[model samples]
Target: SFMVRPFSLGLRLFVAMTAGHILLKVLAGFVVNAGSAGLGVGLLVGIPSFGLMVGISALELLVAGIQAYVFALLTSLYLNDAVNLH
Candidate 1:
């Protein structure tokens, strides 16, 4: 259980971070492709893609912080348990 808990936490964090990055990369590709498609299409697709990228970036930051906090809290709890073992 001890090893499984941290492993699951790490896997969740890894997936969250990787998914956000992959999404941003795909959105960036859309923006670049839209640019070559001309101004109208660029405005139509690029703007929304850019906006979504920004929003996702912000969300990624929040998720990273929250995950880090959770990881630290769990680590401390484990340490406490080991130290106070009777």
Candidate 2:
């Protein structure tokens, strides 16, 4: 139970950090692919995709901060447990 807690937290943080990056890359690919298709199609598809990427980028920034805070909080909690252990 004790070990699982930290492991799960780390796993969750890892997945959260990576998933955003992966989605951003996919969106960027869509923009690039659409641009090569044609000007009209490019404007239609690339604009929204690029906009989405921008929004995702901002969200990713926030997630990063939250992740850092969670990590520090967990680490402190773990240390406190270690110190108080019987």
Candidate 3:
């Protein structure tokens, strides 16, 4: 029950991590730009810049966790669907 499919889990985790990292960068850019101009978003200057990097890192970690959990859950669910019958 604790074992994960090596190749599948690896691939799933890789995909999640890559996608999450890219999304974080794109979203952070918006925050950075907004901080420079919009809504006197300049108010975000002091900490938002630092916050953006921290957010990206946090998101990557979240994605890693999600990938592991989702992959394992789905693998088990699939196995159950295929093998366990009422």
Candidate 4:
């Protein structure tokens, strides 16, 4: 039970963080590539991509804080379980 909990928790958090970063990179790439195209195309694509990137960046920051809190809470829960067992 102990091993399962930590392993699963870590894996889940890793996946979430990786996915978020990858999505951010992809969105940023779209904006950069669009800028290379032309003024009109760049205006159409770059604006939306930039806005989405900003929103996602904010979301990622919030998620990072929430993840830290969750990790700390779970650690405390595990410690409490261990102490109560003895």
Best by lDDT: 2
The list of candidate 1 runs beyond 4 A from truth reads 82-86
Total clashes for model 2:
0
TM-score of structure candidate 3: 0.46
Query: By the lDDT metric, which is better: model 1 or model 4?
Result: 4
lDDT of 2 by residue, 1-86 (tens): 67787888889898998899999999999999998999999999999999999999999999999999999999898878877985
TM per candidate comes to 0.84, 0.90, 0.46, 0.90
Worst 10 residues of 4 by lDDT: 77-86
lDDT of 3 by residue, 53-78 (tens): 68778877877787778887977876
Clash pairs (backbone) in predicted model 3: none
Worst 10 residues of 1 by lDDT: 1-10
lDDT of 1: 0.89
Candidate 1 on 1-86: residue-level lDDT in tens? Answer: 66677677778889988999999999999999999999998999999999999999999899989988988998788778767875
Segments of candidate 3 deviating more than 4 angstroms: 1-15, 24-47
